[model samples]
Target: MSTDPAEAAILSTLAARGPSKSISYAEAAKALAGNPPDDSWHKSMHPIRLAAQRLARAGQIEILRKGKPIDPDNLHGVLRLRLKEQPE
Candidate 1:
């Protein structure tokens, strides 16, 4: 399915903060909606997580668990997204 909006939001949010930052999927959702988390915020997650998976596969980002990257396809429990490498 088309996950462009979420994909763009994820990358933009990360790029805007540079490689020193990371973003949770919920943050991606809120960033995409241009608002804070609320009753409607959960609605944004599915698309955002899917976009996370795609971005992870493209090697443009990483899916982190316990401060380290994990396999995007096999993820479980809480996670966050960060740039695959730090800025030098």
Candidate 2:
């Protein structure tokens, strides 16, 4: 869990969707911006991506491209976020 709103929203949204599902940057931005998100949600894209990077680095989540995990620093194009699968 994170105190930062972006990070927390990312986690909570993903958790709600379950581990096998992934969310687009826009979805996380919407989650942060609130339901029926306003145009201001558009402003949250970069910050949400950055927060995903931080969570990815900490092994709390994964940044995916082409449905495969990619290094957060190298993110590009359309991306999705999902919680890192816990080892059982």
Candidate 3:
């Protein structure tokens, strides 16, 4: 488990974005964008995907397919994430 700041930032941003009607890899890339060129969207994608998967497994979030969350959902398809609130 690498705790790279950039990866952590990406995960935190996604969690903060809340549950959307739909979310794409491009959207995630955009959310993690920094300065132009320096903030290359493509470079951040792989890490973002990995982070999302890890978060999903930990039950911190649910990845939805066709507007619903389920394992049968296609991994290659677009996803909408639902974030779980921290217990008080």
Candidate 4:
């Protein structure tokens, strides 16, 4: 699997944030530091969103919409993500 530095960094930050749930793109960008892939925060945000989507699909994280948990909220809309618990 090809690892994306930006995606990795964002995931790490999410792991660190933990529990409370839901993160905004602006907040994520600031936490990652240095602009994302495309240099423009606007353009760069797409990968971060994609990473979150992928993680959610793999059951590694939960995606939220307006604070309530949901699956695949509209991509063009605002997104919020939280880590998922591993099966015990």
Candidate 5:
């Protein structure tokens, strides 16, 4: 479990969606902010992105742009997150 709420929320949200599905930063932020999420949820976006960068670098998650995985360090524009595929 991550000490960071954003990291935990991101992981849990993606886990709930399963490996084949992905979610946007806003989605993760809303999840972190909780259901019926308020405007304050927007505040979580940067931290969510940061946690996503860390997770992607660690191979715990994959970052996508234009529906394809891209360099985690080059994150920009709209991005999505999904669990990294597991070997069969």
Candidate 6:
């Protein structure tokens, strides 16, 4: 339970997806912004991406791009957030 809408949304949705699945930052962004699953959701990506980096640093999640784990600090293009196998 975090005050950050992006953090909350990312953590909650990955939990909802269960341990084996992953969620895109875009998906978490939409859920956080209360935006419908449409083009408008794209607007939430930047914040959600930032939140993902923080979450990853906290060991709460893993940041990924193109099906591979990525350095949140080096995030460039598209990315995703998934619950870490052993989150802190």
List the global CA lDDT of all models.
0.85, 0.93, 0.61, 0.65, 0.93, 0.84
Which stretches of model 5 miss by more than 4 angstroms?
A: none
Best by lDDT: 2
Indicate whether candidate 2 or candidate 4 has the larger lDDT: 2
**TM-score (C-alpha) between model 6 and the true structure:** 0.84
The candidate scoring highest on TM-score is: 2
Q: Could you tell which candidate, 1 or 2, scores higher by TM-score?
A: 2
Name the lDDT value of residue 13 in candidate 4.
66
lDDT of 5 by residue, 1-88 (tens): 7889999999999989986899999999999999989999999999999999999999989999989998989988878999999899
Better of 3 and 4 by TM-score: 4
TM-score attained by model 5? 0.94
lDDT winner, 1 or 2: 2
TM-score of each: 0.84, 0.96, 0.62, 0.69, 0.94, 0.84
- Model 2 over residues 1-88: C-alpha lDDT tens digits? 6899999999999999986899999999999999889999999998899999999999999999999999999989889999999899
- Write the candidate numbers in order of decreasing lDDT: 2, 5, 1, 6, 4, 3
Q: Which pairs of residues collide in model 1?
A: none
Angstrom error of the Cα, residue 8, model 6: value is 0.3
- The lowest-lDDT stretch of 10 consecutive residues in candidate 1 is 33-42
Worst-scoring 10-residue span by lDDT in model 4:
35-44
Q: What is the C-alpha local distance difference test score of candidate 2?
A: 0.93
**Stretch of 10 with least lDDT, candidate 3:** 1-10
lDDT of 3: 0.61
lDDT of 1 by residue, 1-88 (tens): 2349999989988888776588888888888887655677678899899999998999889999999889999989999898788465
User: What ranking of all candidate models by TM-score puts the best one first?
Assistant: 2, 5, 1, 6, 4, 3
